[model samples]
Target: MSPSTLQAPEIAMRPALRFITCGSVDDGKSTLIGRLLYERQLILDDQLSALERDSRRHGTAGEGVDFSLLLDGLEAEREQGITIDVAYRYFATARRSFIVADTPGHEQYTRNMVTGASNADLAVLLVDARKGLLDQTRRHAIIAAMLGIRHMVLAVNKIDLVDFDRAVFERIVAAFNDFAATLGFRTITAIPLSARFGDNVAERSQRTPWYAGPPLIDLLEQIDVEDDRSGKPFRMPVQWVNRPDASFRGFCGTIVSGAVKAGDEIVVLPSGRVTTVKEVLAPGADGKAETGDSVTLTLTEETDVARGDMLAAPRARPQVADQFAAHIVWMSPEALLPGRSYLMKVNHNSVLATVTDLKHRVDIQTLARLAAKTLSLNEVGVCNLSVARPIAVDAYADNRDTGGFVLIDRYSNETVAAGMIDFALRRATNIHRHAYTVNKAFRTALMHHKPAVLWFTGLPGSGKSTIANLVESGLHARGAHTMLLDGDNVRHGLNNDLGFTEADRVENIRRVAEVAKLMTEAGLIVLCSFISPFAAERRLAREMVQTGEFIEIFVDTPLEMCIVRDPKGLYRRALAGEIANFTGIGQPYERPEVPELHLLTPDRDPAQLAQDVIDELIRMKIL
Candidate 1:
């Protein structure tokens, strides 16, 4: 039986179907939205008047009601005649309620679609019948799949422009299905419609006698949506700390998953600290509330917890890690390269981070794997990340709530990229069964002392290797086990196969960082002197070891001093057009925005600088 046929008559407070619409500017998205709202009688008279006023404001068509003007908000967005931010609308019929997200329709704004569809249970991808299956369609579909949106409805809009030709609709559906088959989405309900003419939008159309199916709205009302949160694990990310009084402390947030009750055992993440729920709070109710309800929860323990911490069932807790692997989408005009740090925001929480390594770039057009050194604008790639602080996270597949993160420029606060967590590096494991017996103490004994790494990052010929060797000899005389990875010595042998390109520079630093990490793990004081040049690479090397185990000592030698100290004369040749990728002479070097320690040259003696580095290490208590 049809669901509406036997349903009790009542108002729907919340939408049963959550969907978003994405298409190019000329695809008539706003017209379709207007049609849905108008037919459902959800449009307020004031809203219609506002749209009319806006229509005349933009010198729109008279009386006919400018449907496009309905969605055009913001002067800049309307001036450009495109959607900017994701606009949400709500409406309902006698049966199921509808929540629609109208997202921007530009190739560069692919990241916005991800944000819109991340929470959507269904996605309605409208395609211009005249312009059959475009790249935007594929891009939107893949994003919906990536965000775990399974249900899909391909609305073949603008059928009136196509002369109601059945072949045109079939051809478009065939093309989309041909490509979409490769991905994980199979439940697609394609329909023909003309939002401008109001055909096949609310009811079955008489225009297309050959096509017999329920209208777009009817299909939406009838389609089954499983929001059964009863069986799923409970998750509540504390978004607000509500301390109504000093005596009452309540953690407030929306329940994204299963139900929780008073006195239930819950664990706060990244800490593994367990506690009991003292109060299951509704805004003002004591009764049980299911998922999708915003409420304040008070735990039994009077322990201190604040925003960015999550309350979930202890058994299904998320991983706590300071570093992780993720699939990142580069959205900024500036390409994403290693050796640069970014701020990562996961869910409601944010942290500082760096793209340590780019694994492989995914070809959106062909779905082929392309080996890339850096991520260009609007590119998707797998990469490793080292965060400044620990984040409580889960795999994108397991839980979208904690799996996704956004990369922001640390200085500017501009959101540069969006990332999906693949796995955590220092992921919390079964402490009961697993053991980390090889701690820092075990490594220190084997190396005859403690494990330490000297990370030197600066412009080329900054006397990094010269000072490193001198320090290594001094430390050796004191019977300190040490290894010196000079830039010239290692490049000639260990990294001889690598080049001096931007991609090669990242790879060189990555290999060196890994070697230093291994050396520290093996309990040796390793002096890694390289013109790594990028602050991000230096930070990654530091993150690999425990606090104080890795030290960043910047060789503060001027470019002119480096040119004079160039034993290979490479810098001089670079200035004379003999070399192309020489740092400080030909290529640009990003000065260390923040360094742990700085050593000056041509001003301070080499011995003083070396001793200064040693003194800092001893003070840090890592010696």
Candidate 2:
């Protein structure tokens, strides 16, 4: 068969491939992409002339045009000769079409690479033949695997510099294969090439005749790029409520996965409202809708459906929950504040959300899970998130659209993190709040006094527990039901598993505040004494209780005084470097700025402070 006739069969059988190129800096990624475009005749004559002019002025190719200039369009990139952002390019050959993303190779810009690779079908990892696989190469490969790129092409670039030795190519391939096995990649292809000289990219290289493999272009053209969602259950997130007229209503969005047709049984998630598909309207299409189609769907019966609501097949409905365990990539310059509220955008839905716990941060080099309190820029961590309301979501491995989300700063509107849901916490769906007939109101009426929680916070050795004990004693003497929760005593039983790290401290305060809330709801006065160094965690505790029922009491004792009065010898241990993460020493204490009551403990006796608290409670009508 003639070459043209042979190419016709391959052209009719292949689909467009979307892939990304990434590795360490100066690995010839830009040059490889530019060479592919040039070979395909995608550049215009005017563009070629400008490229030649630019090459003459500032070129690294000596006498030839510097192909790297074609993709590095940013001023900073040109000046520094490094990629800083993801650059997307489109081109086609006689056999196949391609969409390629040129991603950054620097460690600080790893987040940009993640953004580009999120939608790619494959990855082309470039490696310097002289340096083999560097740390950045391993990082990119791991990230690509995490983003679900199963197909990889390890292009051993700059082969010309290494004299195109077949043994050198084999050694690099062996090492990469050993490491790639641990990543669970389905397919890995290694090729010997020189992107600068255009060898083994579009054409076979004569220098590496000892190595036998197809060129890079042939491998991309013949690879299967079919997705597995074609036969899965249908899912669509409502993007907008289409109300063209008083009589017409529809839900408009793109079908992210699976297939749907008219008369299919569907349910609106989190609401659990059942409905049938009345009509499926696609742009100039028949009566069916499939994945990637943007259409308007009308239900058989009128139901209250709005933006962020998910429509899914009733038999394969998604999990509805307000809490989830997720993997997050921190993108903002500011570190992730554990208890601070941020706006979470999942598909078309937005909700107020908080990172409730930081499970662990992944070490990109060693792939180890390290305990962490906060995630910094370009860091990856596992965390638990709590949303204001329940949302219909799937595990990210099952469906990317419904399981991926971004956290935006509420004040600045800047995107702070990118997250992928692993799964909903079991308690979120398994446990339900059961209401009892005898409630807080009946308990308060029986006690003949309003229930209240007095939270005492200060530095260590600040006389908080001493004052709290005396106040509880006074309340008991007056025939009032009361309980006192001292930090040390509770830590010995309830929070025995917790430590002194910031993350553990947050959990400790959270558990204690919850117990106190329950006690107050039982119609008893509750006193909580703890250092509670972080203001954010303290605020979270206050939010768990009823408005006006939580009263903050600040024990204003100077740090120097607490150190001098070191009752537990904790300060001495901290000063001697025998203890770590001690509040007032290694960690910081965020003092309450506007407590309901402030007591100066410098010259006051414990009984006097206790009497003052009782008098204040009486004035507030709590007695």
- Superposed Cα deviation of residue 269, candidate 2 (Å): 1.5
- Model 2, 1-623: lDDT tens digits are 89989888787888789999999999999999988888778899999899898778766788998888899898888878888999999988888989999999988888889899899999999999999989889888987876778899999999999999888899999989877787767889999999988899888989889868998988888888677876778999999999989999999999998888899999998899999998999886477899989999998999999999999999999889999999888888867878676799997989989888889998876678999888888788899999989999999878877888989987579888888899998776667888989999999998877899999999999999999999999999988899899999998999999888776787788889889999988999999999999887778778788998888999999999999999999999999999999999999999898998999999899899989999999999999
For candidate 2, report its TM-score.
0.83
Model 2 poorest 10 in a row by lDDT: 333-342
lDDT of 1 at 56: 70
The 0-to-1 C-alpha lDDT of every candidate, in the order given, reads: 0.79, 0.89
lDDT of 1 by residue, 1-623 (tens): 76665564433433478888876655767778888887777778998888777767662345566666676676776676677777888877887787888887787777777778877888888999999877777777777877777788899999998899999999989988877887676478899999877889998888888888789888888777665555668888889999878899998888777788887898987677899888877865574455778888887778677788888889977778877888877888767877566778875787778777788997777767799888887687889898766778888867776688889876467788878898988543333334568865786876666788988777787778777888887788778888989777888988999888876776688788889887887778999998886656676677777887877788888888788888887877888898888888667777776677878787888888888877776787656
- The runs of at least 3 residues in candidate 2 whose Cα sits more than 4 Å from the true structure, single-residue gaps closed, are 1-14, 44-66, 73-76, 243-246, 285-287, 321-345, 350-390, 406-419, 422-430, 461-480, 552-576, 591-623
- Whose lDDT is greatest here? 2
TM-score (C-alpha) between model 1 and the true structure = 0.78
